[model samples]
Target chain A: MEPIIIEGTPKTPTIKFDSSKGEFEIKGRSIPENSVEFYKPLVDWLDLYKESPLNKTVVNIRLEYFNTSSSKCILDVFKKLEAIHKAKNDVEVNWYYEEDDEDMLEAGEDYESIIRVPFKMIEIVE
Target chain B: MSFNVESYFSDISSGNPIHFYKGNIDSDLINKVLDTVEGKLIKGNEHSKLRKKVYNVLVESLQNLYHHVDKVPDDFEDQTSDKFGILEVIKEENGYRIITGNFVQADNVEKLEEKIKRINRSSHEEITELYKFILNHQRISSKGGGGLGLVDIARKTGNRLEYQFKKYNEESSFFYLNIFVSENY
Candidate 1:
């Protein structure tokens, strides 16, 4: 599958999904006016990747902030990864947060508690 | 009390007022506003993390107005502008405060009051629990929000939400929501 590289906008995030390398990452703000519309392609891309996912899939989520709608869409993204992880594939989600951003840290924890995939939290220093 | 436009603006713009818009709002206009606010924050040299919180709160607050804005009662002059709302983002000495006001049916106020009051009454730990519970078992509304915006705002700022309402007529009222985020938090 061809890689998906979407540059970040002020209201959206940057999604760099390299299916060949089984590397997926999302960064920056994600508060799109219509999150479902913005996230549809990525969701479909993950659905395609399930058939021939790389030996180990690593997802790096380094978002500064996302609104309520984006939060649900993000959880949907995780569910996709979980589907692959359940099929005996090696999957790891690297959740990064700023050192002082307790909210981001806890947001990661919330997702961790809900999703079954292994989450590696990385704290970025101020 | 009659709704005085000047007093409403003055009350919400207590701090160093940065931007205020009052009129019909939609997704297109909201994206434009978000862009302008992001530029202002970036130019102000706010720390990256702090900037994110302010921007996030602004997104939720403004979007709330966009999705659920009700007619300001047909009797209030022109009907075209009845779908209007007010937004004021001010920079405080310590951080920033976001104030948004929009008209809604008088009947909805009761449910909103109960919801916000419940949120305001919780401690940090309790809020965390409620946030998780809601997020995990989310029944997303038509607005695409799972009712997590208010909880997220409280969690991010560690501050209670301040709000008030003024009746516009027999059918509608203006709802004002105040949220402040401290840099320390």
Candidate 2:
């Protein structure tokens, strides 16, 4: 499948899904007015990828901030990844937060508790 | 309705306001608001935790204004009634305060008031449970939210949601919501 590469805007995050490289990343702020619509294609892509899986999939999520609506849409993204992980694929989520950002760290923990995948909390020194 | 530039400036100037605007809410506007707030927060001397928390709260608060702003009444005596709103970020000695105000239909104010009152009264534990429960059971509203922004703001602060509704004639009311992020937290 073709990869999804969306440039980041101030109100939306950049999404890069390289099927060939087995790496997916969502970086920057995600507070889109229409979050459900904004994330629909990315969610749809993961659904199609379920059929042909990579040996190891690393998903990097580094968001400076996201609104409540974006939070739900983000959960939808994680749910898709959970399915892949449950199918026995090597799926790992690298949840990055800036150093001393306790709120972001706890947000990652919230997803980790709900999803079965191993979440690595990576702290960026900024 | 005509905007009071004088009073708006006075309210913001009462404190060390970093950003203040009252106008349309769109992608560009949201981006500009967050950009200015984030840059200001990073340049300040607050702890990383407080800075990030305040930024997150500001994001949600501003988005609320964007999605939930009621259309200015047809008889609002203005031609530029495009879901306008107001936002102000003021600096305090101990923390930062975010003040956001928007127009809401008079009929919607009762329910909104009740929701905020419930959030203000909930303990931290109850709030966490309420937030989780809403995440699991609540359907996303047509407005692209699950009605969690205010609750999430309360949870992030671990305090009451300061809010008020001022009567704007009979058809609409101006809703004011405020959140404070303290350094000690």
Candidate 3:
């Protein structure tokens, strides 16, 4: 499958998903007005990726700030990955938050609670 | 409509007006508002946490206005009726206040008021639970609103949602929301 590589903007995140390498990353701020429109393609790609099996799938989320709309969409993205993990595949989520950002940390924890995937809360020191 | 729109605008126009806008609210305007406000917060040397909190809440507030604002009264002047709304950022001694004004259909007022009151009355833990429940169960609306914006705003600010509804006419009313971003937490 072809990789999904999109650059980040002030209102969106950088998305780099490589199926061959089994690594996916989303970084930066996500406060788009229409989050569903922005995230629809990625969610669709994940659906397709779930069809093929990978030895291990690693996902990284490094978001400084995301609006409530983006928050819901982010959860949707995680739910898709959770399905992949539940299918007996090796899926790991690395959630990165800045040091002293309790909100972002809690956000990661929120997803961890809802999704059935293991999450590593990595704190980035500024 | 007993609500004096002119006086309300004049009343909030006081204080250190960091930024004020009254017109059509589109995606472009939302980006500009976020950029300008984030720049001001950075220049003011606000703590990163507080800055992010304010940015997060502000994004929700502005997007709410963009999606929920109703049409302007036909007789009303200054016709920017396409998603017409008012936004004011004031610098108080204690913290920054983000005030947004928009028109709402009279029929929808009761539901919206009850929603705000419920949020204002919920404890932090309760709000968190409510947020989680909705995130897990609620379907995203056609407008891309998951009914989580208000709840998320309250959770982030740790403050009650202050609001007012001024009767504009039998068909519509002016709704104002005052959200404070304090340095205390």
Candidate 4:
């Protein structure tokens, strides 16, 4: 699949999903004006990815902040991953947070506890 | 009933330290407010980190107002009545202060207070875990009543939640929440 790239703003994050490298990275802030509209394509792509199936899928999330609607969309993305995992494909989510950012790290753990996929919480020095 | 519209505008637009918006809540107004805040924030040379925090807080607070504020039909007989809340941002000595106020039924205040307290008490790790748990297990409430918004705000601020409540009338009270994100902190 063609890579998905979105520019990040103070209010939004940059999303880079490279299908060829099997790497999906979401970075920056995510407070879009319309969460549903902004996230529609990413969700759609994930749905398609599930059908074709990859040997291994890695999702990297390094979001500094996201609004509630964006939070919901993130959940939707994780749910899709869970579905893919249920189908017996290798999938992992690497959640990155600033070293002092306890909230982001806790958020990663929260997502990890709920989904069956392996979630790695990494602290990066900013 | 007579309405003191002039006084209302004066109270909001006067040379008060805080810039306040008071009136009907809608998406258009929310965006407008964000634009105004963005202009001021960037002027202070806040760069990307401060700007992102301010933007996220603005969105969450406005969403709270839009979803929780009591509303009556536009054509209601009491045209003077206002249904929405107020949002204010002030420049403080150390950093920016964001404040939101709205009227809520008395019954709902306790739940909200409890949620804020829980967020304040939670460790960074706990907050992260809580966010994920809510994502997987909590169903989004109809009419946007869920606590996910508050969770997002708390996570973004990375500071203790500050709030107060004042009785507005017999059946309801005005809830005020103030969050401070210091430039140096």
- C-alpha RMSD over true interface residues, model 4: 3.4
Q: For residues B85-172, could you state the per-residue lDDT of candidate 3 as single tens digits?
A: 8888888777788889999999999999999999999999999999999988997787667799999988888999999999888998
Judge candidate 3 at residue B100 and give its lDDT.
90
**Clashes within 3 Å, all models in order:** 0, 0, 0, 7
Report how far off residue B163 is in candidate 1 (Å): 0.7
Q: Which is better, 1 or 4, measured by DockQ?
A: 1
DockQ list for all candidates: 0.64, 0.62, 0.80, 0.42
Per-model lDDT: 0.86, 0.83, 0.88, 0.74
DockQ head-to-head 1 vs 2, winner: 1
Ordered from best to worst DockQ, the candidate numbers read: 3, 1, 2, 4
How well docked is model 3, in DockQ terms? 0.80
TM-score of each: 0.91, 0.89, 0.96, 0.72
Q: Model 2, range A15-123, lDDT digits (tens) per residue?
A: 9999888899999988777888899999999999877879899999999888778888888888888999898999999999988777788778878877789999999
Off by over 4 Å in 4: A1-29, A32-45, A58-65, A92-126, B1-18, B72-83, B121-125
Residue-by-residue lDDT tens digits, candidate 3, A55-95:
79999999988888888889888988998999999999999
Give the per-residue lDDT of model 4 (tens digit) for A8-28. Answer: 875668989887877889998
- What proportion of the real contacts between chains A and B does each prediction keep? 0.67, 0.75, 0.72, 0.50
DockQ (C-alpha) of model 1? 0.64
Model 2 alpha-carbon drift over 4 Å, by segment: B1-14
Writing each residue's lDDT as its tens digit, candidate 1 over A59-104 gives 9999987888888889989999999999999999999998977778
